[model samples]
Target chain A: MPFFEAVRLALAQIRVQKLKSFFTLLGVMIGVMFLIAVVSIVQGMGNYVEDAFAGKFLGVNTFNVRRFPDFNMGDVTEAEWRAWQRRPLVTVEDAMAIRDALPAGTRWAIEDARWLAAQSPYVASGPQALVQAVTPEYFAIKNLVVTQGRAFNEQEDRLGAPVVVIGTEVAEHFFPALDPIGKELRIGGLPFRVIGVLEKQGTVFGVPLDRQVLGPFHSALHRFTGARRGLYGVVVQAPSAEAMPEVQATVRELMRRRHKLRPAQDDDFVLESSESALTTWASIKRYLVLAGIFLPAIGLVVGAMVIMNIMLVAVAERTREIGIRKSLGARRRDIMAQFLVEASTLSTFGAAIGIGLGIGLSKLVAAVSPLPASVATWSIGVAVLLGAGVGIVAGIYPAGRASRLDPVVALRAD
Target chain B: MTADAHELAGLSTTGERQAVIGATGAAPGKDWVIVTRGIRRDYDMGGEVVHALRGVDLAVRRNEYVAIMGPSGSGKSTLMNIIGCLDTPTAGEYWLNGVLVSAMKDDELARVRNREIGFVFQTFNLLPRATALHNVELPLVYAGVPAAERKRRAIEALERVQLADRMDHRPNELSGGQRQRVAIARALINNPAILLADEPTGNLDSQTSEEIMRVFEGLANSGQTVIMVTHEPDIAAHARRVVVLRDGRISSDERRDAFVSKLAATI
Candidate 1:
């Protein structure tokens, strides 16, 4: 018989036994659904992280020099940790020295930022806000745009002027009814004029990007309790992305010389670029993908088993039909192929439903939550292939058993 | 006995009278549709051997309408199975259309069955799920007929059986006689060298059985060799020649008139 005829026969059988087919394929459907949905969400998160690292948190041409690597805390070796601990802390002095040593046209900023316990400016309630003490160049280095009044000038930062730039959220909270740029807001029981309000930068990795205040480094050092310890980090921007490697090399050399480190000794600070961040994220995404595929693969195995069991039953039930086919001159291979096609048809059907449901589920999640998700085309392909593969593998035993049946005995079966 | 019965009986005993039987490798010619010499079949019933057929010799010629008749456990069904290529004989040579089929393997037998023989069953055995046209198309499908040609041939076969108007109806929708005609159409669609029927009208009423017998008569008259296996004396009487089996051996071979007269005498 033609292969398509066998497939059409399988489809007719499936149609005749709709409820049984649905129940048999349910496990595969749910398995594929889970796989596609999780993969889509994970891929979406990866895309969002890439965008945030390149545009919002760390601009494409910018790099950060810190006392320790920011994102790879768990990956640090014991010896590396000890070596970094022996190094001097990155301070405002080192930030200044590195800035001066860099090539012309390069921009740099030093800032210390941390979440601090505080009371709301408008209410008696306590709220936590990110407070940053930064130099005048911080705004340019971080690519933050002032939407309201002008940013504090070099004179204000040099003279330790008592002025602040607030984020959109802060501006909305403290001066909802008035212009926030000229208003006064108290931080840590000290009053400072809001010299500027930043344009809104949305969330990144679920963290609100526009929910903080910035103040001149000198004023913050004098007024904030923990600001006197040291600079948290230094941000540097090359002329363009092409010059970033040279800028990094110059900064490293300048910092090492300032700290009096010999040629053989490791530098105390870590220079993190967007590339390193993305590489780390990629590694994490790899694990996420494995975990996503692994759990759902268990479901697929169970689904395959279900299909195999049901197919065995079907073969047994159609023993006489098989006998009739054999008597009509159907070879064992033809019978086997028929049953195998039937099994794959069931699995592929389940997979198609799974794809639809998975996309719907991901869309639902995106709508209800801040988590972003988009279906990956490759994931859909994998889902379909996996479903069909499971079907073929599961059908082998049952199809073989059916094909090996003795026609005389099968024809006699009631 | 009548002159025809005497002649058939003489023909059945020719090899034995001439001492030419049991020639293992002797091949029959194309004039002979089926020839079995000392064919035997045994079943292993959990170590106890049950002999189904003990050296039964049978010969059928081209275009001959022959009926094999026996009671239950007389080995006639087993003989029918061997003739249809559904089972191989245990220890003898069986040839169909000049081919030594008893020595053939399972898949080879299937191909031979597809190209050389057609089978009609007691229950009509139409696939309950398929329409009459699809049922008739089945044999051609196994023969690897192209789809268009297969449909055309199947339609022609159904039309020959006078089932063209009912081609779209399923087995359940057709009457018992109509179902048997569809089965006959399926059996003939492959244009096999012989038509093998196993109690073809066993499930139908007498009127329907007669209706099916008339169809068989037409087929045999059209030069198609027809082999029908039945226990009914009247059913066997419809064939041109009748071979009666008793205790796994041929007890008598006679023409239709002689067999019917003997049946009437016994009643």
Candidate 2:
């Protein structure tokens, strides 16, 4: 018998028994679907983390130099902490020195102070609002938009102006009236002038940036919060995306020298990118993708076991055909090849449908839920290979049985 | 080589005891297609030994039309099964074309059976799902003949069986005699050396049986070896020779013409 005719016969048998074939493929379909779905969600979360980092850290050349490497992470001895406290705490002097010491490609640099634990006055007419204090250069680095009023200039900082930039919420809360940018309002019992209204900066964790009040560093420290603390950190902006890595390296070298680090000593400050936030997002999904790759393989192994058993039954049912083929000059290898092809087709078809459905379902999840996802191409390839491999391995025993059947006994079978 | 030598030795030992009756006078000078010696077939029926064939020696020349007659359990089917290579005897030697087939392997025997024999069963065992044309084509297909030649040969075989017009009809849609003819067509498609029939007319009515017997007689007269197993004396009388078995042993052998002359023509 020709192999082509044999294949057609097998396919016809499957078509004649649609319900059995459907159930057989269903097991593989479900396993592949879970695999692709988990891969898509992990991919989506990775993208989201990267975007969130872009939001939090705008300047590509930006690097933070502080006593501790990362925020609240590295250890500093009590003696070092006392000495650090006594040293000028990131003053404008330190900023000027570092600004002059940077390389030729270096661009704008500025510093601002922040009280780590300062509570914002939450005033709400419709929704809650928060206030943050930043230097005038904060607008330049972040390039924040002012919807309605003017931001105070260098004169305000020179004279320690008590004016503040009110956000959208501030206007909506105390004064629904128009042009309230010039109005006076006491925050924490301190009279402050509203100089400008900041626009929205999108939302994160259900809180919008337009709800925060922006102010000069001195006004936040001396007037509103009533504390005379130095600037917290400095931020720098590069000219272009191409110059980011160079500027970052220069800043690190300069910070290392300024902090007086020896050759072997580790820097007390951390230089990071939006990549860390993305990694934080990636870490949670790493386990999920890992589990997705292997967990469903356990299901696949179970499904393969069922496939092996089912194929065994199929071979037994078709023993006479096996024998007949053998008698018709079919080699043992030929019988094995035919059954292997059948098993592989079953698994590959199942994989294709499952991956297709899984990709669609992941997209649906991203649209309707917070679970963001995007299917990766490599994941699909892995799924196909896995399904085919499982089928081939599962088919071996049954194919052996079919190939080894004696033509005489098989023909004599009742 | 050692196993082959041992097989040859075993094959000679598988033949029954020496038959003194035809020991020297059996001048089988012409080519004999089949030669059996001391063929004994023992079957275990639920631990009770049933001796189906007991030292039955037989010889069939080319183009011989012979019928073996016996009651149930007289080893008629067993003898046919062994002769047709559908089975191997417990202790016996069957020489088809002078090859000791009793000790051949399964695959080797398959090649021999395909090349040497055709079988027509009384039940007309055409596949129920296949058309008459496809049923006729089955044996040729198994022989690995090319598709074009195979199709042509199958059509020719069906034409010989006078089933060309009903070639597209499945076995279920065909009459009993037509179905039997289709089966015979399938059997002839391979052009084997011998055509073996087991009660070929048992499932047909008297008229249809006679019709089938006419076909058989034509085949034998046309120089094709035809062997049949039947219990009816009249059916056996149609053959040129009749061999009888009783209690697993051959009771008598007779030339049909001489036997008919000696007995009454009641059949």
Candidate 3:
């Protein structure tokens, strides 16, 4: 029979049994919907990490030295955590020693970071911000641009000057009507005059990039409550991208010598580059993507099984119809083609609905939450093809059975 | 075609029919629509062999309206199946429209069935969900006719059965006689060489049965070969000739007038 005629017949059958068709297609719809929604969200997160964390926050050719090896605390074992705790703190003296040992063009900065709210006696309730006590070169090492006034001078940093640089959010909240460069703000009960206001930076992973206050490292260590506990890190910047590896090796060697560690012992300090961080994130993202694909694949398998069962039932129900078609000169291939078309029609319909629903869900998530989400065009294509593949795989046995039916026996079937 | 009726009448004896029909692979002339020589069909029911047809020899010429009648176990249905190209005989030669179809493969038989035979079943056998017009277009669809041509021929066939006004109605919406007329139109859509009707009016009332018989009469009168299978003597009387089967073999073959008189005398 003609291809169009078979399609027409299959459509008519679906229409005649509307409820059954809907239930049969629902499995594929839900499976595809879950697949698309999760994949889209994961893809959006990957973009978010790439843009906000890898590109903007961590500058090129820059690396950090910390007491702990990994960024997140929960990822390390108990013994590893104890070992890291036993290691000596990364002090400002160590930072200076590393800088002196590096190439002349390289720069380094030390910071004692803490979450502390800044308040102004001029305003009723001031914004809470992450406070970083750092040396003057920290701005240059971290690639932070000051939009107003100027960064603290070396003399002021050395004398533990009571000068501060406020981020864009702190400036906007504490001194909205006045130029914030010369304003005085109290951070953790210590009063400091703002010498500069940094340019606006966007959020990263839900943390506001602009909500921070920078103070002279010496001044903060003397005034802040937790500064004496020795929680501090060093940021180093190579003169160029090509010098990064050598600079890192020199810094590691210099730190090991300064600490007087034995040659057989592992280095107590952790050195992390922006490239290394991004590589770790990429590997994690790969696992997320695999999980996103694999979990929904279970749903697709179940949907395919449902399709196979329904197709088998349909074949049995249409035995006499098959016989009639055979008698009217439909070959086995024709019968097989007809059933296969019907199965694919069922699945493709589900896929279309699934694509729409998945996109709708992603849009809803974007609207309702802080997490980013986007539907990749390629993911949509893969999802639709997967649905069709399920249909073809599920249709094979039943269509083959229909094709192999004995026409004489089928015609005699009641 | 009518001039060959005398030669067909002369080959009446069983041995004479075999000699005329020849053995397997012999070429049949154009005037012969169907010829079966020593055709046998066997069925294996769980290792027990039951012979359905026992060396039956039959010949049907073009434009002949013949009915094969028998009791339930007489194997008349088996003979009809072979004649319609729906089945191949177990052992023997069967020819239809000058082709040796018994030796043909399944797909070859399908093509032969499409090109040379049209079937009307007792149940009307129209696709229940399709409109009368689409049902009538089915055979032409299998024959690979183009859409416009198929539509035109289907409409023309429906008009021939005087169902033009009801072309869009489904089988369930039409009366028994209308449904049968639609089936008949479908059977004739491809203009096949033979119109094979199996108990065509078995499910209809007597009035509807006569209406269906009249349609067959019109088709046979217009030089179409028709082979009908039925157990009803009255229905068999509608044909120009009757061939009765008993115990998987032909028991009697006679003109319609002679069979009717015999039926009347027996009653």
Candidates in order have lDDT scores of: 0.84, 0.70, 0.84
Q: Write the per-residue lDDT of candidate 1 for residues B42-90, one digit (tens) a residue.
A: 9999999988899888887777899999889999999999998999988
Q: Give the lowest summed-lDDT range of ten residues in model 3 chain A.
A: A67-76
What TM-scores do the predictions have? 0.94, 0.71, 0.91
TM-score of chain B taken alone, candidate 3: 0.94
Residue A266 miss distance in model 2 (angstroms): 4.1
- Writing each residue's lDDT as its tens digit, candidate 2 over B1-267 gives 254442322211112213322442333333566777778888898999888898888877677788899999888888887887767888867777666787777657667766777878777766565688887776666567888997788889989989899999999999999999997887777777788898999999999999999999888878788889999888998888788888888887776765577556454
Isolated chain B TM-score per model: 0.92, 0.87, 0.94
Give the DockQ of candidate 2. 0.19
lDDT of 3: 0.84
TM-score of 2: 0.71
DockQ per model, Cα: 0.75, 0.19, 0.73
lDDT of 2 by residue, A42-133 (tens): 77766655564455444444555444333322245788666555543455555666677666655543444222221223342244345555
* Model 3 lDDT at residue A57: 59
